[model samples]
Target: MIGMLVTFTPRSGTFDRSTLEKIAGELRGPFDGMPGLRFKTFMVDEDGARARNFYVWEDEEKGRSFFTEELVEKVTGIYGAPPVIEYLDVVGFVDNSAG
Candidate 1:
């Protein structure tokens, strides 16, 4: 599996608990059954100044294929800032519930 971490700083006065929940609600349906997507988790700082997305993909190519310029722009537009995207080789993972 491949892991991806995307972090971004939210624009001034643009992020809050309500907005974060709204974003999560909007994403639930479309991302539920994406091809090559194993899992995804969204996180934000308690102060709502920053956010991050953690994704696990079936493979590196699949992971890379999902990040497009349009998507980047969309995220940037939503948060009012660009994101820093990082790809990593998933050396190991542990899921207790799956056991």
Candidate 2:
């Protein structure tokens, strides 16, 4: 399995509530259709300027595909510049429910 974490600053966090709604719509729409995607999670704080994305894919290629040239260009167009990301291998997970 492959894991990815991304942190980026946006061009403007001034999307307003409506713009956020639109983004949400797009996430569930064409954007989610990106290839090689397996799982995704997004984190945005109340500060409204910074965002983080955590992703998982079947392999390194899939994980890398998320940052495709086209995707990067389009994302930069809306969000700004580029995001710094780290690719990691998941070591282990703790489970307590069974205990």
Candidate 3:
């Protein structure tokens, strides 16, 4: 498995908690069934200064394939800045709900 973290600081005065929540809500359904994605989580800082999207994919290739320029542009359009993307090799994970 591979994990990718895309983090960015939003432009000052461009976003608030409510706007962030609304954007996340709108994205939920589409992202829920993305191919090659094991799981994903969208997060924002408590004061709404920063945001991140964490994703676990079936493989590194799959993870890399999704973070395209168009996607980056979309994120930039919303947050007013490009994200800093970081990738990690997922050594392991513990899923409490798995049984």
Candidate with top TM-score is 1
Poorest stretch of ten by lDDT in candidate 3: 10-19
lDDT of 3 by residue, 56-82 (tens): 998779898887999989988876779
Which segments of model 1 are wrong by more than 4 Å?
none
List the candidates ranked by TM-score, beginning with the highest. Answer: 1, 3, 2
Candidate 3 residue pairs that clash? none
TM-score of each: 0.88, 0.66, 0.87
**Candidate 1: worst 10 consecutive residues by lDDT?**
10-19
lDDT of 1 by residue, 1-99 (tens): 999999888656646778777887888787898888989988888877788889999878989888899999998887678999999999998877676
Model 2 earns a TM-score of 0.66
Clashing pairs in 1: none
**lDDT (tens digit, per residue) of candidate 2 on 3-27:** 8887667665533445545655677
Whole-model lDDT values for every prediction: 0.85, 0.67, 0.83
Q: Tell me how far the alpha carbon of residue 91 in candidate 2 is from the true structure, in angstroms, after superposition.
A: 2.0
Clashes found in each candidate (C-alpha, N, C closer than 3 A)? 0, 1, 0
TM-score (C-alpha, index-matched) for candidate 1: 0.88
Tell me the lDDT of model 3 at 83.
91
